[model samples]
Target: MKFSKRTKLNIILLWVFTALPMSIFLYYYYPSQPIDWSIFMLMVLLAIATTAIPIYIGNVTIFFSQWVTVAAFLAYGAGVEMILVQLSILPMIFRVLFLQDLPYRLIFSSWMFIMVSFLSASAAHIAGYQIGSMDTIQILLGATIFMFVSLLSNHVILYSRERILGQKEKFFSRDALWDYAAGLVTLPFAVALYVLQLTMGWLAFPLLGIPFLLITYVMRMYNTAERANIALAKASAFGHELADRLSVEQIVNMFLEHLKNLLPADNIYIIDNLKGNYVVMRALEDGHEMRIDVPSDTIKNSFIHYYFTYSEKQCYVKSSEWVHEAPDFLKNDMNSLLIVPVHRNKKTEGLIILTARKKYAFEKFQLDIVHLLATYFAVSLEKAKYVNAAVEKSETCALTGLHNYRFLNKTLEIEQNRLNSNPHLILSALMLDIDHFKQINDRYGHHAGNIVLKDFAKLIQKNVPEDAVVARYGGEEFVIILPQYTKEEATKIGEKVRQTVEIHPFLVDSDLTKNRLDEIIYITVSIGVSSAPEDTDETMSLLRNADRALYIGAKQAGRNKVAEYLK
Candidate 1:
């Protein structure tokens, strides 16, 4: 197998920039340095430190191990310092292998470290730090120079690579400065350790451990805080998404999708309290999802039953054995379970139950995060309920529960625009009126007339296709909007409505004050059909044409028939 042209060039450049210097350094200086035991230990220590855990601050990463590198350089001469630099490449080797880089790239990376280490040694020598000397000020100067050289070399390489690759990002911006700042923090401490070693002998080595451990602990704490901030940010983003959803099912599904990714479990169940029963709208078992309903009473009596009762604390069961009273279905193929209640207005609206195949699957911090997410779900659920209620009230008629005049006009306008965009598409409109509705009201009662109108709305809803919209236009009148229907198809639908209403019996109570019905009466409706691009393109024109047709068919034609608009 042959390498790509780019890869070949990279390999050649790596050898020129790194391997050449390494060969020269070894030939000129390797024989003179006799491997001092103490210096070798320092070299090994520096290598280990460089490879250990790295602390990320903002956009920059600080490797606390570099402190050991500086100490090795200050205590030993340029030759030992150079060897320490070459050995420090061990960590980079591991990283390159972990990333699965080519073998050539790993060799290049090791050489890159060697070259940087040589430059750092040259800077230290220029700062007047001699081999094995105990000069405190010179040690400090060399340490400072070493840090600056290492930082500059790394940034230069990064900037050059990005420029060659045609990247848009500026490599030498404020973020670079942050990286320099991170290294600066460790420099002073590394120099301090060298100073202590000179004054206190071998005892000073333990002194380095004290501050190293302290700094390590501080970085760990910072990491914990950073993770918490990220979790909160994720929860806040999900909350905004949940608020945009209009239905309880939509909100619950969205919340569950995000929750599954954030927390892994063998099984997850979202049980909603609908009509006083716990119905599982979504259930996941070993990654497969299904919907099932668990009886509310059965769920309440289970070992995880505490979730039904409102409480701030989450019920975390680490082992199934502890839950001896758990339901048979729940206990089957489960080792651990966690139950959290979603509360709204101090009432438990629902429960989020998680099960794991292994015991003690969830940690304390994970449970805390789950509780936080559940709270977010609860708040969003309540908000969606109110939003849906307000929308329903605005769109529906209060008396008949059908789409009102406002919705009718809005729908007609929308359908008109759709028809305008597609000239070939058809939109059919119908104007319907009950025959002798006023006479019925005067003879029977206005309340009886209302019952007939409501029954008429229900009949229209049942007779029309699901895609058609039936709306109450005004008193004793209604409109039906059907998309993709020609005048011939709409006339057929209108005829069906007329026949159904003509034959059906409408029950009414003879006594106005009583709720029970005692009488049955027959009724009929006349319908006018008008279609878009066939009758008229305009919405108001279509409505007027249909109304005129209704007048001709119902009034002039002696009522109870379907009429089509004549051009």
Candidate 2:
């Protein structure tokens, strides 16, 4: 495929910035100049430095991260000093080209300040070299002009940068090359204009400094782009590797740890949704170490309220604006924060906030990545919930609504899993039988018997605790898995079930005649209750005992009563 016009233009611009100016700077400085070796070295240094101007102008003002900016500036400055000492203003070339022949104001300010600095040094060493009055006035006038131009340049540079450069952005090779050319081509011209102004009188033109500024801008673009690429590649590789190796909880923690490496924030917090309450899993303040805490219920409630109110967009509260935005909870303490709403299947799940010591510490891209990771976490959590639900379902019976035979085994599994935390707790299993249910089906049609079973089941359901698990064992029999209850407690539940079923008339009238369909009837049920084994090894014996008690209750004299199984 053919490249687009923009891509072609960028390619052309890169070659020009990278190759053309370096060739020209080389032609002037080689072979014959005094201290040619030193001059060429300085030229090389300046050429390298010129390419960093774009990044400096774009990123420095907003992030206020002076360390890297200063590093790049120094590198550029030293390179210019070695490669093209006299002609260090390489931004002028691009200022004439890309900027529509209009000069960037930074060029004028930067040059003017240097000129003033030189003049100040000269004036300090003047030793009262009294010039004529006219010359003195001319010198003062020139100084004033330079200072005013420099101040204007400063303002223009700031405004231009803020409007032109976006937040948390990365640059590419094509853009970087443009910056390199701008800085390289303009360095000579910028120096000439400054030196010429000092040598030649009122005839000098300051606008000539703009082309050099443009070159500076281009150089910065290159350096910034290069750094961004390196950072992204490293983050991607590390994140992928870490994600693969770590467990789910560790991955969550690593994600929290990695946010600081990519973005700037004063504080980072991870609040997990634990039963409708926010549990602060981790907190980062400044660049210091992180702290983990299980906060109070009140604190969790505060977080829930905060999230419910502002879980859509992001909440950024400045120190000055804190009183207005979060007067109650923030209470004038928060500086600035980014609040992102985490979602799953269009439902709000939780909220995340990354705060900055300064105002507006977050960018859309940073927030996007952060939220993207959050989405992954949301999906993982959703999967975990489904798994837990499935596990719970497997432990109980689906039909007859009572647990199946496997339930006794699962009860032991849970008890083992509980780690003996609560020894005071007791569990019981109650097996119930519809007395002579099969014989009734033989005598009174099975349809009538089915009604009896369902009616008796309803009575048992009403009498048992909400926590009780009641399910049909098979035809004519059922079971109840009762937790935190002893034999006496199980007896109470069983006895109540027996009495309710024996008295509650299932049918209003009997069908002693030939198959009367409108017959109302009553039924009796027998329940056998057994306690859980105190020792883990005795679980099987406990279940067998419970089953035997059920048979005993069936054989007992009373038609509707409860029986306890003793070891």
| Tens-digit per-residue lDDT, 1-567, candidate 2 | 234556456545544564345434433432122233443343334443443343433233211111111211122321222224224334433222312112323233343333333332234224332211125444344333323332344334444444554433333333434443433443344334334444553233323324444644655566556655655565666555554532456556666677777666656776666566555566676655565555446554454456644566565545554344432333243466676767767856566667765444554555656666666666655665676567657755554444555665666568544435665667787877887777677666766676676666677788899988776677887777787787898889888888887778776222344656566556677777787654222445555666678777554656576878855
lDDT of 1 by residue, 1-567 (tens): 235678768777878776776757743663223445764575467456644556655445456666766776676645555556667656555433312235766665656666677777777677776655566677677788888998898778778756766676776688788788878888987787667766775566666755576667677677757766776788778777777888988887788788777664778887677767666668877677775656767766775456676464454545545457775446455656777777777887777888775555554566777777888888887888889899889999988899998888888888878887888888888999898998778767888888888888999999999999999989988999889988999999999999999999999765454554568999888889998888787988988999999998666898898999886
TM-score against truth, every candidate: 0.65, 0.45
- What residue runs in model 1 are displaced by over 4 Å at the alpha carbon? 1-61, 73-149, 152-177, 215-341, 345-373, 410-426, 507-520, 533-541
Clashing pairs in 1: none
Model 1's lDDT to the true fold? 0.74
Q: Candidate 2's error at 311, in angstroms?
A: 9.2
> Which stretch of 10 consecutive residues in model 2 shows the poorest summed lDDT?
62-71
lDDT score, candidate 1, position 515: 58
